[model samples]
Target chain A: MVDMISMPDDSTTAVDRALDAVLTRLAERAIPRGAAALALIRAASDATTGGKRFRPALVVAAFDAFDGDRGATPGLWDVAAAFELLHTAFVIHDDLIDRDIERRGVPNVGGTFRSRARSLGVADDGADRIGDAAAVLAGDILLYEAARLVAVADIAADQRVPLFGLLDDAVLVSAIGELADVEQAVVPGEPETTQLLSTAHDKTAVYSFCAPLAAGAVLAGADAGDRAVLMTVGADLGLAFQLVDDLIGTFGSEAQAGRDAGADLREAKRTPLISLARETSAWPQVSSALALAPTGPIAVRAAQRELHESGARDRLVALIGQTLASVRRRATELPTEPRALIERLATGIEGRIP
Target chain B: MVDMISMPDDSTTAVDRALDAVLTRLAERAIPRGAAALALIRAASDATTGGKRFRPALVVAAFDAFDGDRGATPGLWDVAAAFELLHTAFVIHDDLIDRDIERRGVPNVGGTFRSRARSLGVADDGADRIGDAAAVLAGDILLYEAARLVAVADIAADQRVPLFGLLDDAVLVSAIGELADVEQAVVPGEPETTQLLSTAHDKTAVYSFCAPLAAGAVLAGADAGDRAVLMTVGADLGLAFQLVDDLIGTFGSEAQAGRDAGADLREAKRTPLISLARETSAWPQVSSALALAPTGPIAVRAAQRELHESGARDRLVALIGQTLASVRRRATELPTEPRALIERLATGIEGRIP
Candidate 1:
């Protein structure tokens, strides 16, 4: 059923065009402001490039499923592009918070500016601060740019308010989720399982899944009931995706995940897996290994081995499986086209679990 | 003549109501999210409080001047509130970029979080990072909240797009201005007078004055010619206001300005005053004093004395006067009501010069 509509590739192309249009307009605006403005715009362009466009895909899928004349609607592409812009904004800020200078094996916005400042002979700390400021400004531009796109999108007047509301809700919820994540890191305690799962849901699921799906439904003039169903399905899918992502971050090969396998452990990030592992018998060895100086490869291996041997890995995998099943069940209430898309996305996420 | 419309007090009251309404709506949304979300909401409330409501006053004054109904429009209040929210967001982010943890003798949003984290046993740098994260999230929320208020406000549908565009332009321009400021600090070169003044205009004037006035004109359904006149007046007023602010930051008493007088010299900020001072005979003394470690009272006094003795302070003050005269001349092109308001506002700004 999903094959009837050629997804993702076509959707990705349309969204790219939409994004290009936005950048062109921004460039036109920046040119009059001078070189500094132009440089910031260029940095914005670089930061937004090369993402998988996952959120845009969900927006397109839901919009296509709900609207009969899907491909004919150019506004759908702008809507998709807005989600991608929002995602880029979040990614830039997240990198700044993590003090990470790289993303996707390249210099992120902060890293790029840090390098520029260093080349100009700024001290290390001064260069880092400049990089942080640039990242903040870049994120600010994209954040408002996303709202501006939605406000100007060629949709019905009545639909604009709801879409704006959805975007606002998503930003607020995601910020709270991020705050909780940061708090857990510095507050010196093990987060409860429910708190950990809720943090994952709020931080990752709401903006990435729920809002995009709902925004698509709103753009397509879907009824409230159908929109609610799609959002619930998105919630389940998003939670499952985050859990699987955490697993990949901890145990998957660097080549497969495109990130360091030991990063979460090195940072002592409290995830659902970590929360569960804290109660296991192998926790002592895992804790002691984590305590070793330098947190080298030996410690990471011992921690991973203990997690696997204690069955925490299996439990988390089971949790992910249950979450995906819930997505499938909730998706049944949506229309057939969206239901198929949701199930397919879930399956793709499931494939990430080792 | 300005007394015919009862000036800022009434406008301030209306703006307060609007800001309160925004906080009320935000609190209602946060209640269900948990304690962390509520803490964020509280921080936002604190951050938004106790400002002179300067931008909101501009919004209300311009709106009332254009619209005959005056105090009858509720949407005007929301519009005013939106500008205030925007201002608060900028202030928070600016403080973060400047590494300032205090504002107006109080702990800012970042400082509040940093203190909390420290009390909870986090080390200095870790607490600072946590605080930076909180400030980022807080600013993000207020930034979008500003847009959301504008989006949901009760106004003609067509007016919304232009207002959104105006807000978008202001945000982007202000960001570029901030980027230029950061770049100048790290790149280690004397900035041209034109560049310094341009940065001030972009960083302070557009969002602070032009956007608020233009937004008010839009809400009141004013003609394009009238709107352009007000924006031009805003540009001049904003430029003059910023020039005066820099002068005050350099030479005014702390009790009068409610800020540390020597802070700008200590930071070696590149304002028009500093740019002009670089060309004077006293440049050597000022430069050497600035290079002194600790940047204590002696260095600040020597720098300030050199600025005055070298005539740089007088030049900046004269520039401010000329800018204000230009604003008054431009006001002649606006309607009588708005013209009165603009002249009064410009006079108040002039009073700030030391």
Candidate 2:
């Protein structure tokens, strides 16, 4: 019955619906003061941490994938929204650390605050300081709100204990990855690109992929063994998604990228393409290509050629495909969710231009 | 029997006992690996939030003042430590926003990380990124630790309800104050010094004074009214402490001031003295006087005179005295802590300079 509307399977749609419901509640009640309300609204509006809301889709889809009555637990929606809120909080902090301003058109929370402060007649320098501080707290508030939502999930509180513990552990691990990424950029040792990607995976994949999916699965009657599979699948899928992001960051159009082309080159972000590009034997061609690459189309095209000649891009894509295959295998086994829906969402993202 | 040891009423002894226990435990723990350890240690080591252990003192004093039986609870120490942890977290993040750098001769968490990143072989730009990121997480780690500690407080879970709720509320209020301070600084408002101080009171005093002292009093069995009185006391004391700190920042000898002098001017931090100094008929004299203030003995003398003449320092001292008197009067109905011992400790700080 749940399979009829592809909308039911849409992780993005499901998460958004759930998140909106939760946010609506916050808007209606959480804060009464004008300033506090505005701060929250500003933070909630920042979608920087979220990517495609695919993880959230997994949360809802995983529940639908179950054998239980489809609409029985209306309360479960807020639970799923909780994950999205947590994800949003994570992204807020991430954007700040990345220093790549602007997300989804509006300035990220930090930038937004800076702009808002300026509008309020704050000086340039002081605005930045104020913006950053407010943004940090805004993120903190979202995190707390996320916890509050999660705590009220319809599932048996005792059963959700492990999930709560895991969520906290994941928070700690993801933070470590961010630290490592920042530290790596500062240090001289050109550690293997594998290390950088691993940091990305640790910081992102498990939580975005496995946790949300497995949590929904757990609510839907999945056991410990099922969680292990989901984690592996999620890690692979997460890596693939990140590589796609890196590719897009290097090659997408100005409006599409939401950041500068080759920002990684200037920021020295350790991307698979850059890691491979720097090591090319066609050294002069690659360097000149990198230097002359002005627009996104040109840079991406140049990067694409360099990658193919060096065989790095192919290897990276092949690696991505392999990871997706494992993810597909999990999707196939987990019939609780609409199989066609999960497949469509995952595969379709790889093809999305912007 | 409880009086046999004659514990001083000074906030430090209580805080020291609480802090020493926690740090010792932290040193023995696994530290959770990689960047997590750094995050945790940096949180524990923050000096701006550092105090003479006053909060833990307040908590204990509250317990004493309310006739809280020493033998009643198993985890009173943990309770006191929890308040201190929360207070320290507030201080660390506060300093990050202020960007003053030096706190008691050691570089702040952000500054320390930036320098150490390079020393650890991280590159300069990368180190800067790492530092900001660390400061952000370090704040979170402290916040997380405070929650964990408070969760274990010895009070019956039901009785601890107010404290639990207070802990959460404090985070929100503090964040609002922070946001306001940031916005206010940028806007260059002509807010009277009292209004400016009120922002500080809400952000710093309410939690620094009202919350911890009230938490202590609650545990010690004080009535609601008693808690209110303690808040008034803590508020003034906190204001005084902040004012003195500001004076020290602008005018103290480098040896005593630590960190960067004239940091307030550079950051445009909204301190009471700065606000007052900005005022006055001797405007150029005050401004030029500020610019010429040296980092050592001469700087201290010049700063003292400027602050004194501007009337800001005198106002602050007067406010502090008033608040303390009120706290003393309100404290009468409540059971006394070791008053003689506390008075002795207070006397020691008396002639040491406001």
Candidate 3:
């Protein structure tokens, strides 16, 4: 009856059910005073609509692996949902900062609101301002709502503080990561591999991976040593995941990625792959491709070819493999269920790169 | 030792001490990257400075008023500092949204960063982008720090959840208020008085007034009924505070307010005073004055004179009086210390206007 090998087999369905419950609660509560407030709420709701639910799965997987009778613990559902909502908030704000008009092959919260501004007959700059303002508010509210869900989760009273702290720390570290990203964009040369990796750790690893794992472990009243190990494993997994994401952003098909493939190049994002690519003689071509304002397919293909020729793609794949190997080594020290699940997660991340 | 009548007389010292402690911790924990991340942290630290610490004062006052051994509950200090930090985050973001160059008679976070970009030889648009990005990241980190402080406050385990909930609610409601404010600005005519007040309640009331009061009460383990009363009193006081703020923004000298005297009119902010003035026969003159591109001294004075002549100032004063009166009526239902503090706060708000 206790099938621990599958690790998050049913967690997705449970998490989705919980997310819908949260949406239902939000829908029932009327936003006071009128259409504008409602519009922000609608945008927020839309932002929470679709995502891969990867982070939440890690949370439930961690919780399930450590705690007994995982099916009996209902609080895991809310925690998972909260994690997804928090990710949505970050994505919305990230798009606004990058000035990207689309996400998941559709208009993002900012783009959708910008269209609304135009329909309202606002001037171009005016419409942009309105769109930006609306998206900022929407992101702000969603972040708050995410925390609120966690606070109200049916977890033990003593468990709530650490959980909330984990979420808060994620935001703080991610903000630092984002700031570093902006800085790297403005500077002349490419950021080194270590610097780029550190930013990825701060921005995506700790929050998207470590926090979820540590939070789930803490919620199950796990020991400090167990929690620390899980966190370490999560950090490595998260780094590997970010590397894979960069590869997809730089070289994957737009049809497969569901967004602009050349966005990283156009924005001159200093990803680890690009950082590694810059170390070779192909730096000039890579630099020019990145410098393109509205990066065309021709530029993207040229950049891809240059990166491949420089062996940067191979280097990135090897790096990802090394990270997963580290995760696997760390997993050996964990309990049976968690060890299996973590190894499976590592495999999943490894499979995503090419 | 209680000193009930002098609610929060020593709170400023305590709150300042705690705020300093927070900043010191932030400075010591090195962001593991480059100068840009460090610069954002520095800008965030600067943003936390020079404010009146108004919301923190409210939190301490409410706590001091109700709980015995007012100075003994050191957790109040952390709660107070958190409120102020939260306010700083909002102020930074608000300045970015409004594109304001100055705040408190000096360059704000955005302006300071923009100057940095210019000094770095970035062009005008690039500098603006850098400024906006930095401010947004700064605001995000500050908000996270604010919540983290509260989460780690020296309160009971059961008490932590509600305290965190209150902070989260404030952010959610305030975001809604901010959205309404943006919508009102973009629309053609002046916003109705009721709509303006609702926005005020959402923006200023929940965060500035109610959250502080309720947080203080929860820290003291106050009952639901007492908390409810404090929140209500806070709502009324917050509305009155906004009315006074609008008056100062409109008619007071820059020296008196530590900001531009006519910024509200310049931004075409639809304040309650302006709403009332628009009802008078002075509509055309007031409209033209508000529509001024630079809103030079001449136009500002003209707008001021028109408002005064239209009896808008008098009506605003009367409105403040009514709000304070309502606050007093509610204060009478509170315990002795809270009653005295509430009445005194009302008196102070009333004295702020002309």
Candidate 4:
């Protein structure tokens, strides 16, 4: 099962406090827009809470690794909060795109707004429209707020441009990755390995690992070489992390992953495992089972068996191992603080790799 | 009717060149991602072209009005280009949200992608998803590019903070206005006049007028008083602009407006005209016709007639007149160039006010 019980630490507490500060500031401003606007902001605020906070942790840990004099900087918290907020916005839009009604064991942003609209006695289609529109706007607002936070951050004048560049690139590239994903799933053929890898790197690796780590280093006045190294390490780790996520998504139980199991199969997602399985002797059965996925659990189970027997799982495990090793190797080249933090994250990712 | 026939002036050409430079740079980098990614960018580039370029004109005119030695600054073009890019992004998302299939007399970004998917033999639902997803990502990329352009702009360090603030606030507030729009349309009751006015200011006035004008003034190193005045003038002009737009949407011919006439009535949109009609003696007929809108064209036309005969059209004309007058009065407080530009735009709007 996914761990939700880590000991309360100073860094963790600080991140939470930063998030609360952002919400408080936004809520105060939301007051003037009256009840409807206030309700929208509150929904956004609610979405920001209760994530794994993994991205923020990476931001702080990466920054801490540089051994910068933390006392001299006032914007570290804001930067960390900005990463989490970006993640919040991404998840909100992702849920809407996926038509997912639940996230983190509760109604997601779209679902929350949909429920609210229904309670107001709107019709079914109208309620769906309201919910989707609310989620879209909430995501948009969070994105603006995130950029605003970083734009107005108390960073050195020289650092702001590069930092904003990194942030913007991450967001832009992730969107490109998301489009690639939709194209792969809908284009009526098996997706190429290159396309899948590129998508994974853009969507998960860069934002989750690369951007936050590089940002932290940049803030700490790292040189270009150091920044490049951090980016490489983050990208590798992020890809490996996503592989593990896909593994859990398919093979693990709902209780372990905090989501509906078999959703990937039901959606006919073209994961690496799925594409590789298509190359095996069990291709016919697996493809047929995928076609019958939602209505026929037996068929889906058959597909799962085919994937395992076809050695796709073993192949994915090997890839994850190699990727995580690369991350570790890169981390050792960094300073002691970052090396230890990255090593820890790598180990955590390793446990879930298969 | 939008005057799509405006001659290409120096400012327009400058904005176009900036956009072309951005596209060229992105196109170079897009080589590694293959055809799909490149096609997506091309669609975005296409969406950025052939607009009235009104926002950019405002940015340039307002900056010119400040009488900054035009030859000294290098970033005005970038800032002007940023506004157009922002507008492009907004229109893309707006089309997606409204499910509008056409824009600028052809298939929009979403429709283009949807067509691509369909031609590739994808199912109808899958094609629709592809289209919507592509539009979302395209809009997102444009927003990032806009911010990046501004962040790296060669403006003074002191000015970047406030400029970013104006940009962020406009985006956030516009999203709120969009949400208000969806809510107003879906909810059963007549929308309050206050809500309509607020939505207009937030969606149209702030971004289209106030932000551009203020941004221009700030770029030209104007004092806070001058900047504030420009914002007031912009807000008034923008609201007047939107009122004229609403009037055209209701009363103008399909050929003139370049879309299906009575679309607002068919969609049960809560324009000020609709709100006013609800208060008139024609309420029953208007409401009944609205209810029957999608089933028959006759019902839609009947609602249009009720709206006109109920005196709602005259009332909206008067409101537009009063709002435009306020715009002109505010403009008289500004420097000559912006005052003339605003007056010219005001007169253009006045022709469509009824």
Per-candidate RMSD vs. true structure?
2.9, 5.9, 3.7, 3.1
Candidate 2 per-residue C-alpha lDDT over A201-313 given as tens digits, one digit per residue, 9 for 90 to 100:
76777677667766776666667776666666767766777777776676555555566655554443567666766666775676666655554556646755665587666
True contacts kept of each: 0.67, 0.48, 0.39, 0.52
Taking the tens digit of each residue's C-alpha lDDT, what string does model 1 give over B1-354?
122123366677877888898788888988898887887888888999877777777777788788636544567788788888988998899998988899988999889988888888888888888888888989988888887788778777788888987798789889988888887776776779998899889998889888988988888888899888877888888888888878877887887557777677777777789888787888887667666613588878887887788888888888888888988888898888888888788888877777
lDDT (Cα, tens digit) per residue for candidate 2, span B266-319: 444567766776766655666665666554546646755776787766666666
Each prediction's Cα lDDT score?
A: 0.82, 0.62, 0.76, 0.78
Whose lDDT is higher: candidate 1's or candidate 2's? 1
lDDT of 1 by residue, A1-354 (tens): 122223557667888999999888888999999876886788889988877777887788788778636745557888889988998888888888777899978988888888888888888888887888989998988888887788778777788788987897789888988888888877776779888888898888888989988988888888999888877877888788889888987888886667777667766677889888878887886677656613777778777887888788999999998998888888888888888878778878887775
Kindly report which residue stretches of model 3 are placed more than 4 angstroms away from their true locations once superposed: A1-10, A27-30, A68-73, A260-269, A282-299, B1-10, B70-74, B118-121, B161-165, B266-268, B282-295
Cα deviation in Å at residue A343, candidate 4?
Answer: 2.6
Q: What DockQ score does model 2 reach against the true complex?
A: 0.35
Judging by TM-score against the true structure, name the best candidate: 1
Which is better, 1 or 4, measured by lDDT?
Answer: 1
Cα error, candidate 1, residue A62 (Å): 0.6
- What C-alpha lDDT does candidate 1 achieve relative to the native structure? 0.82
Report lDDT (Cα) of residue B346, candidate 4.
Answer: 81
lDDT of 4 by residue, B1-354 (tens): 245113248777887887787777676666676776787888898898777777777778777778765577678888888888888888888887777868966988898998999988899988888888888778877776777778777777787888887797678777778878888888887788778977877787878888987888888888888788777877877788777778767777776566777666666668888887777888887777778876656777777787778888888888888888888887787777767767877887787654
Ranking by TM-score: 1, 4, 3, 2
Q: Among these predicted structures, which one has the highest lDDT?
A: 1
**Candidate 3 lDDT, tens digit per residue, B1-354?**
011123344667788888988776665554554566677778888888767787787777777677635545657788889998989989888887777767866888778878987886767876777788788778877776677677667666677778876886688778778877776777655678888878877878889888988888887767888888878888898899888888888887786556677767666677888888878887787667667725487787777887788888888888888888888888777888877877777777776664
True contacts kept of 2: 0.48
Query: lDDT score, residue B39, model 1?
Result: 75
DockQ, every prediction: 0.67, 0.35, 0.48, 0.57
